[model samples]
Target: MPGKRPLNAAIIPSAKRERKAITLDIKLEVLRRFEVGEKLSQIAKALGLAVSTVATIRDNKEKIKASSQVTTPLRASRLTRHRSAVMENMERLLSVWLEDQSQRNVPMSVSAIQEKAKSLFDDLQRQQGESSQTEKFSASKGWFVRFKERHCLPHFKVNSTSPGSNADTYPDVLKSLIEEGEYTSRQVFNVDETGLYWKRMPEGMFISVEEKAEPGFKSSKDRLMLLLGGNAAGDFKLKPLLVYRSEDPEALKGYSKPNLPVIWRSNKKAWATRAIFHEWFTYFFCPAVEKYCAQNNLTNKALLILDSAPCHPVNLSDLSDNVRVEYLQDSTADSMQPMGQGVASIFKAHYLRRIFEHILEATDGEDKATIREFWRNYDIVDAVDNIAVAWEELKPATMNSVWKKIWPECVHFQSFSQTDNIAWLQRNIMALAKNVAFEEVVEADVGRLLQSHEEDLSNEELMQLERERAVGEGENEDAPPALRQLTTEALSVAFSHFEAGLQILTSNSPDEEWKFKVSRAINDAINCYRELYNEKKRRSKQLS
Candidate 1:
């Protein structure tokens, strides 16, 4: 019963719709741009966002980042509106539940998953004393679909796994590859991939709270995949493939990818994906084998043994007849895998020792208090080189002994002395830790860390840890300018690093053989230093 007001009295709706909630990724982009000296207006215009929106993102990034992530949808989303924690808690628990079910071989039907998600969401809400919100979780098919994709779970297809009984037939298959294909033990190869947490120390080094902090550094999550392969005769070992958690790490900027010390690859997860596996087989594995066979005067014949991982590429379409790819029967890895015998263990043991060696090498002669600072520079780029060296150190004996359980026919000698070798490595490890490193290390500390360096990770941990490093991570750091060139200072640092390694080896060499080895190393290093020094002197003369 009221008449329309005049134009001046007319009310106007707010022009700014409650701006759509900015996502974590957008927030990150804003922050990254700001750090690189971009103006607020530039960032805003580039992203097609308001200047104030960009400013808010930059201002509240740190506080907002800790709470918001892609995994937790925006507060504006209907599902997570007023109860983001409920969604987060539910997602984490359901993720674990789904994984447990998968491990138990329970069928994960889409409808079944949806029901579970809804139940878990309901249970979480009650636990959080928010049951009165009156908004029930449907875990609707649409939401479930997105969630499944986000977790990288394959479509609703149930995996049909049959009990494997053809394990005994594997020998006959190998015989056919050898007798029919005429591939020798040297040409017959078995490859396997393993995960390593390079940063994890033994449990004794830290308390449970510190070691397993939920939001802190998870050694279990900081992982790399080593794709290792060797023949039964141990006469040939493929160049190891090392995958790290970066595409173009700043630590590796100066190095040419073609001349990398190892076959390097990267992904967020640092895992060997199907595409990566195929690429390796076609390019690296095939060429390497072809070259090896040429040197051995054998036909271009090769056989590859693999495990039954779904992600493993089964087809070798690129190299058809010359190479035969065969997968081991399911449930036969522990008993039949050539890699399981001792190749992987030897590789891992050496890999870890070399890591500590590099750390010691890098920190050599630095002040005791400044020792920790040097450790920061030893990133995955350095770790890759160390890993390559470690893989090369694998003794033929250890590589050949791997066939004992699967193909004893190929084992010429017993691996009993492996224990003695490991003990020796442990002793040297202790020596290096105490003599070279700032801290003292015991045999147990050395053993546990090296032994457990590759934890038997659950499938979920494998996926989570394989996620790519954050956006700004692989970029160069603000401090500790990148060492791109071999300057005079670089030469001196190299010598110092080598000197520390020499001292440790000198102290730990068990016998005359070992002592002679260390002495030879010292002479070689000094000769190298002299060569560099002379080269530098000549360069200076030319300049003058």
Candidate 2:
């Protein structure tokens, strides 16, 4: 809440109004009340809203007025027309880019787009009087930049090795498997390491013009590293990766601490040790791979994908003969990696959600947390725990069901050329949009259905249950039996919702009937525990 800013209250034009009718109405009502003599508090109370809503409405109104009024008097029509044309062209370009994001077929480079926009202003100057195209160019440039930033970026892919190498060549063994049609539609398990930072600015932090910082306002100096991995399914398994800073080249000689932070000013021991990589491989990567293979009944013939990180050893002699590592091209992960495409994003989203929930819980329903204390005390162990819980909550069957809807024409074990792959990706993305639309419909219906009974539990009871479930067990015997009962009930409810959502999203599939059974189990568990908790609560109320 410390960094929170007021929302905008400005009225947009007719076209914009149609695009955001509900939001526009809310903003208008807030602004209308604020314009009256009523205080912000009174207006918020009248509207059944937070006072911050009034503040946002006022801020937005000011921003709209400021942005709409041109400082230089050049007929407003000309500026509006130009802006409209620029927006239309941008939308057209975006459609083209989305259709084929091969970098070669995209309409214009970033520089070319800027130049074309600049030239529009130049043309305007020639038609009217001499004026600085700087402001208009800047505005148009910002719009195009945002458009590209949002919609035009290439898909994320992770491959083994760097680009321009033969590391990506499918081995003869793999080719043979493909030819035999043994690898078609089979699950691909990809393992990679990524670093997570404590107190790092989250992805997509949008700062507006008013709040824009001067250059060099922030530095990436206080990042903490975490190593994480997942497969095609968006599951995450993470471990903390250590970092050391030193100017000295030889200071590594006496380093023996497992989690020690070492710093050296002189060039005595600056080079990173190979032992660190070996340690990660032995303690984290190897064990995870082995365990996963054993648990999943994956034979040695399953495809394993990895990047060319320096820490990844060149030789994998410890792995069985049937297991082979497929190296990806460098810098091309945005195109080939499943984790880069989906899993990593999902993991990061789940991580941030958990972090926000934790912060809210710690602050006793307050949204603020001491940033420094959060970073210092934020244990990677806890983060891993959160991620694991979220992974279990993932509805893989739902995703696969959705994928099947979109790629109905897809054939397995076919050698899809680059063009074929691109077409499939386009179709798949389109299918995903439809799938989400269907899910949104289901979510809306569920919301309506659950609205009446949603308030059966008190806020305090829910929070207490959540906390006890997270902690799992008490260290002291003094802990109340009711608290443990509530925890069990809450966990059952949580898992029930998770499983129910999966069931709804996946609907009916012979292959996925097990999911429905799981959901039913969770529901039964919740009902049993809730009955126990209700009996306890009733007894406590009678005693009181």
lDDT (0 to 1) per candidate: 0.66, 0.41
lDDT of 2: 0.41
Per-residue lDDT for 7-125 in model 1, tens only? 64323444754445565566766775676455788689878899888887888867755655445455425322333556655665566556434322234577777777777777657
Worst 10 residues of 1 by lDDT: 476-485
Q: Pick the candidate with the highest TM-score.
A: 1
The true-versus-predicted C-alpha distance at residue 49 of model 2, in Å, is 76
For candidate 2, the TM-score is 0.32
Q: Can you tell me which runs of candidate 1 are displaced by over 4 Å?
A: 1-165, 205-221, 363-370, 415-420, 437-440, 456-544
Report the lDDT tens digits of candidate 2 across residue range 331-381. Answer: 433344444434433444444445545544454435555534544455534
